[model samples]
Target: MFEQSKKYFSYILNPMELLRTKKVLQVNPTVASPRAEPEEIKIFVFDYNAAQADVRELKTVPECFAFLDSPKTTWLNVDGLRKVDVEKICAHYGIHYLITEDILSIGQRPKMDEIDGLVFCLLNMMYFNEKDSAVEIEQISIVLGKNFVISFQEDAAKDVFNPLRDRLKISGSKVRQNGADYLFYSLIDMIVDNYFVVMEKLGEKIEGLEEDIVRNANTRTLAKINMLRKEMIVLKRSIAPVRELVNGILRSDSDLIEERTEKYFKDVYDHILQANELAENYRDMMMNLNDLYLSNVNLKMNEVMKVMAVVTCLLAPATVIGGIFGMNFENMKWLHTNTTFIIAAFAMIGIPLIMIRIFRKRGWF
Candidate 1:
């Protein structure tokens, strides 16, 4: 029964201490391998309201153009920016090279830029799990045209747009009934929702860290706090650029982004503000925990020193008398006497007791 219970408990438990050292070194994209295949970008278009238009992924420039030829609000989602095929597809669609580079870059800051016929936006989509103490960051760049919206994701492995896609799949969502601008809003809104979830997880981590530090200070707890604090710093840095970019979009008179969606973007800006506030608060708490741990260590050390000093003070007189008695003094009468050792021993033992009694009377110990 005990063995069975142990197995059950093991299934339900996670070793957070072990997880604290699971450092995933971020890869540098400057040296990423060049693609050999003929350049072709994949595009997924959702025609929710109209006669189910081409929701097909594009492999050729002609196919990409075919999707863009109609008056339909097309959504071109290109995955895997490492391929020159994506570049060729973007060129065919008249997307700027700088924008393509931004899409390919791993650590592009979140920002929005509108030029001539396009509204370009770069943002981060983050996922965090408190239970696992893990976070993943991905870059998403969106370009809005008069009748189309093209999205470029950093990688193909993960996406936060699934919920938005699911929402659009339903019959009555604004994403389906409205224009491409609405789709843009829906995607951004979903990303922001994920941000909220990540923030909640981060808050839970901070609270748990606080409890751990206050109850039982350990290196593992301190290390976790520092790691979380660094993650918060990175998160804050990623978020700031995006916030400024969102603010720029909110204030701009871009033809691609409608004024009606301004309120929704404003709401996103508010969410960014709240996230920044929470991150700042968590950082402060982490700093305090560090200080508290240092102070506790110092207090423990001082306690040890105090006890040692007390012991030494009580033993000092005894040590001095023993030294005197152990000296060979042939001419000194007291030293020559047989009772000298007894007298010295009595003095050695009695002095410390007397001092201790005095200390006790004064409540020094």
Candidate 2:
């Protein structure tokens, strides 16, 4: 009993051993954010208005101070979370420490909250790893202030906001012509749009996996199905809550969110509702794939068993005749003549052929 208990708990006791022996999932590498530099975190400010927009990178958090109260709408994007830098910057904006903690933490659920003098929105950015067919996630926190929108990202290496960035460069686009609230709306819209992109890739994966299951299902196929099940759960977990977050924004009374911006946020709400539905649809699809895998496996096994049963039946007559004649001291019918051997052989061969014909006629193969 003592040894069995030790065996069960060994993995926890020696994590190094577990790490050495565990099988790691292999796939294309995800884009990972490098650890923040001890001296600085990456910060980019986009200060844009109807006439013109300025895009620049700042070396320190304090540089964002100039845009805080600027009449021109400002977007400050911070990548990589440095505790000191985040605290200082959030402190400057009067963000609550709890909210700052939530911002710096990775893997928070999608949510919206009003804190201090600003409205904060949290989101999870998802990436599909095509090679392994898995889902990877990053956390995003957006703070809408009086005249600026600051986006905090867990990964500095990649995000889905490049199109929004390019639109900021356009001279007369709505993003360029609007206030900070519109910019905030644009940011949320881009993130939700990315859910569709990830879902599209997953849809393609579903098609491919469905084809593979139909053609031939194997243990490898089972593993793939399980992986897709997990990915769907991850997608759903990240996507489902954003609908409520968007709805909350639509209902919020924050002055930072302008009246005109409510329509834009409503558009985001509709997009999220669609995304949530897609996530749910894909989840159901994954379950169907699992059922398909199981049904195909059972069908294959039944085929093997059917062939075995047919072979056994075809040999039964021969077995009975041979066994009856082999008994000691027997006066078996037709056992004394050479023609008897030939007749018995013919009976054995003929009976099986008749059985085969009957089986074929009945379409029982």
Candidate 3:
């Protein structure tokens, strides 16, 4: 787990690698690699009304466009952006190139923008990868229009929208009676709600680290604390912009967002705020854990130093007596008899005992 955390922290430090886009000049257009074959795009289209609903898998962009023309509220979920003709899809939906650029880019900060009758939003979705034992972040871009809502994701391997899908399948679900705007809000809410799950995992790791620090303060424990601190920093960076994005949506005057839907967004906005607060609390706890670990190590060092000082003090008088007796001066009285050696031995042992008693009385030990 510690090794996984270290690897993830390194990735967070250099997040550009996650995007795989390179800009050659200051004003040059960004270029992406075309070497790798793109994964086959899977499209899920849902046409639903107040009473009934239809869900289908679209094989081509034409199918997606045809589904958009339906009278019912249409939801087009495009999974896997690689090797797909994104330009044609954006053209069909009236999405601007800038918005498509943000969609294709992997490392975009969470943001909301309105342009030409479309509400464009970029969000970061987080989930814990149990197999890897690390937090994984992916960008989810949403485009909301008058009659339809489209979503783009980088990978189709994992998604947090399954619950929302289930809710849509039920006839009496709140999402069934609402329009496309509500569906957009529902999608955002689902993404934000998963933040709590990631935070819960992070909270668990923080508590575990706290317990470990108290029980066995060592270099490994210190390393784990620092790794958790890095993870929290990355999480905070990811969530802070999302709060601003949601706040912007709440205050937006865009026609794509209805007045009724604004209240739902406000709820999501509150969730983001809560997530940020929890992250801040975790960050502060990590710092405190680090300080506690250092204090424990310093305390141990001080104890060792105290013992060495006492031992040195007790041996000082014996060293002086030995030095005086080894001198060549014949006038020394104790050096003329065997009693001198015996008395010297007694003094060596007796003086240290007396000093030890003095030290004990003074509470030095």
The best candidate in terms of lDDT: 2
Candidate 3 lDDT for residue 346: 94
Please, what are the lDDT tens digits per residue for candidate 1 over residues 244-291? 887888878877778787888898888878877776776787788788
lDDT: worst 10-residue window of model 1: 17-26
User: lDDT scores for all predictions?
Assistant: 0.72, 0.83, 0.81
Q: Estimate, for each residue in 1-365, the C-alpha lDDT of model 2 and write its tens digit.
A: 98677645765765643442232222222333234444457999899888999999998778887786798888999987788888988988888998897887645678999887688999988788776566777889999988888898867666988988999999989889888888888888888898899999999999999999999999778767766777777788789999989998888988888797788888888899899888888989998999999999999999999999999999998988778776675677767878978877888899999999999999999
Residue 11, candidate 3: C-alpha displacement in angstroms: 13
Q: Write the per-residue lDDT of candidate 3 for residues 1-365, one digit (tens) a residue.
A: 99789756855975643332121111222654333436578888888988988998988877777765788888888887853567678888888988987877756668999888788889888987665335678889999998799999867777888888898899999999999999999999988888889989988887888888778788678757756665676678678898988898888888778798888998998999999998888888888998999988898899999999888998998999899898999788868897999998899999999999998999888
Model 3 misses residue 251 by how many Å? 1.0
The model with the greater lDDT, 2 or 3, is 2
lDDT of 3: 0.81
| Ranking of candidates on TM-score, top first | 2, 3, 1
Which predicted model would earn the best TM-score? 2
**TM-score of predicted structure 3:** 0.87
CA shift of 170, model 1, Å: 0.7
